[model samples]
Target: MPEQPAGSRPTLEAVAARAGVSRATASRVVNGGAGVRQPLADKVREAVEELGYVPNQAARSLVTRQSGAVAVIIAEPEFRVFSDPFFEQQVRGISRELTANDSQLVLLWVEGPGDHDRIARYLGGGHVDGALAFSLHHDDGLPALIRDSRVPAVFGGRPGSGSGSGAAVPYVDCDNRGGARSAVRHLAGLGRERIAHIAGPRDQTSAADRADGYRDVLFDADPALTVQGGFTVDSGARAMAELLDRRPDLDAVFAANDLMAAGALRVLRERGRRVPEDVALVGFDDVAGVAEAADPPLTTVRQDIEGMGRLMVRLLMRVLSGRDGREAGAPASVIMPTELVRRASA
Candidate 1:
């Protein structure tokens, strides 16, 4: 045991000298010992304890050529990122896995097209080892930019086409179309006819897929029964009003997400429509606080939002492993299952 002359921070060199091992052996032990034998690794650990040695992350990055951090790029503005519980839950999952792997999470958000240049520059700068992005739209250029930057990246949903006909980036998404079909079918089973749909913006993959599911169920129904929404409470309220104006006799409503569903519920109450009595209602995403807190608890399609985020990180780790020879294979894109949860609203 050596007492430090109270001075500067301890370095790897000091730990190596104390352990009677080369700087390289101490380096391997400090940076998660892999090829080193157990007894020698233990000796390095004891030396590190006695010397209180700390590895310099910047220097370590130069040695390993890995930043030891992962970027989480969300394409939404600041307000929506703060308001929406879906992103919150997904980020929680990502943080949990990143902590386990001793990696850092660098959060990057895009407010508009103007921010793309800054984001593109950062991705190419190698500040983080990889990135996980979501909430893509048709006009957003992140998908293509991510591809061209050649950084290991994963999408949170089924990706839209980016750039030319090159290979598709891996992604983790839920069964959005199947979930919407299940919700609409549930309403139909309850003997409600003329079910109207309040759909999300058509540009997003989730929204487009949900709209397709609604059409699949009501293929030959009147075109006026569907209205577009912006996946917001205010938009839901506005769309709900429009639907009533177009089809006052409709007996059911299916909202794309829980926030919109909550908004639609407000409009329904304002218009003096009863839930499941006059019009059966269902929504998707089963978001926390929004769904159950509705006037009557909502029966909606449930997807594993946090689980999807966690799975995205796991997939990215596999890809990183394949690149670095730690793991043997990369993963293909994943689509998780969804289910209908029965509650009072439906």
Candidate 2:
């Protein structure tokens, strides 16, 4: 074989000649080798290796009509995006799945409602094949925008009842309502009445469902026992303080997430409330470095956050591949189960 000059790159034609196959055959092998015989594919692979040839992604995408990339849109503040371990774990799972499928992951952060227009424009520009959206509030307009743009998307949680008329999108979420019920039942089984709840943002479906779970067990309980939180440590602390003031005789508390539970624990200790003694505590998400490290160790509800993230990717891929004919009806969603992790806090 003649050696090519320095600074010259190998092309499909060159690879085809070396492999003793037509350029179309070589192209088919390089582009996933579909419909090509194994022996021919092997020959093309050998030629590509010998010539050190790389397919031009841009040119290939034009032919396949696939960008070979997926977008991960986080509709939250920068602080929450970075500070929450939940998001980090979910992203890790998504990244792994996308890598396995030979796709690129593009992360887009939406700071507030004002950024929705820009995000809609980006999705409509055909820059990615699909998207996985997270941390969406009930009132968020981004979901409808995504629908209108015709970008296949999978949400990380059950979307809230938005004001728009867009059809329901597929989502992957933990069993928030069931988990909350389990927490409340455990406290009830322990004979702890007057159980109070510190709920996350009301607009989020997870928080709303969790609050619903709390009520499932305490339907007849006082409405004042429930307080709203922002799913942050500070918000948890403030909510707990208010709960104490509203119902000082409360015997137990179930925080929506572990971060809030941790905050509640701090106030409980400061106010001389003994965990599992005077006021049993339970949190959700079982986040590492938070729940287990709490003062008395929190007995919380555990959800497979990473698994949820991976499921989101898998669902989006199905939509992109049109494997299940997703558009015939409502997009399918997956609800992962949760369990109660017992500890000293409860």
Candidate 3:
């Protein structure tokens, strides 16, 4: 055979000719070596290396009816995406899992309702095989659009509607309610009464669930003890101030997430309330930097954020591969367990 010109891109035809096989056989081997014999697959691989060939993903996707990519949709403002360590850990897990499966991740940040149409169109355009969505609020219409687009999806938390009107979507979430229950229980065990809770945003299921857990423990507790927060440091600090003003004798607190806990800690210090001495404190998520960095080191409910991310991908991949056995209904959901991590704060 004549030597191919240098610097020219190698094609499937060239690789097939070099391997002494049909183009169809070479294509199968290049895609995944599924049905082709071992010896022939080896020859095709060798030929591919020799010619420095690279498969055209766009062309290959069309033939296989698969994009070999997954979308990671974060339905939050840009600030939250950058500031929240929870999202960072989850994305890391997702990236690791996708890399292991030889799939690509397409990250899409939905800033608001205005971006819904664009995101829906992109999902409907057959850009990815499935999606992993996080930080979904109740009023967000992205879920409905995702449903309409008919793309397989797995949520990072329990799926619900802001207006209470949508069907449930498959999701992988840590046990927010259970984790909160454990945190509150620990405070109770420490004999800290008048316990207050700094809850997360009411629009998200995670915050709602954690609040519910607190209510379960403090059934007859004063309603004024619970203050709403936006899961930010400033919100937590403000909420803590409000709690202190409302219930001066409150001896313990549970902040929905670590960031809020850190905020509350600062306020406690400013107010001259000693952590775990004058007042006990507990936080959730056990975020690496925030929880451990607190002056008194927060005792927190540890959720496997990365594990939840990995589990979301696994579930979505199952649905995409048609192995989930759902009989053409809603996708499956997984709830991971949470554990209480002891520290100096509580």
Q: In model 3, which regions exceed 4 Å deviation?
A: 1-56, 162-168, 323-331
Off by over 4 Å in 2: 1-60, 166-168, 323-331
lDDT of 2 by residue, 1-346 (tens): 4488998889999899999999999999998868988899999999999998989766776766678899999878888999988888889999999998998999988788898888888888777888898888887787777777778888888877763556557889999999999999999999998999999998899999999999998899898999999998889999999999999999999999999998898898899989979999999999978999888999999999888888898888778767345445545888899999999999
lDDT to native, each model: 0.88, 0.89, 0.89
For residues 1-346, what per-residue lDDT tens digits would candidate 3 score against the true structure? 3466876778999999999999999999998859999999999999999988889777876776588889999988889899989899999999999999999998889778888888988898777988889888887776677777777788888867543334456889889999999999999999988899999999899999999999999898899999999998889999999999999999999999999999999999999999999999999999878998888999999999998889888888777766345456566688899999999999
Which candidate order results from sorting by TM-score in descending order?
Answer: 1, 3, 2
Q: Looking at model 2, which ten-residue stretch has the lowest summed lDDT?
A: 322-331
**Candidate 1 minimal-lDDT segment of 10 residues:** 159-168
Higher-scoring candidate on lDDT, 1 or 2: 2
TM for candidate 2 is: 0.82
Clash pairs for candidate 1: none
Query: In the order shown, what is each candidate's alpha-carbon RMSD?
Result: 4.7, 4.9, 4.7
Which model, 1 or 3, shows the larger lDDT?
Answer: 3
The predicted structure with the larger TM-score, 1 or 3, is 1
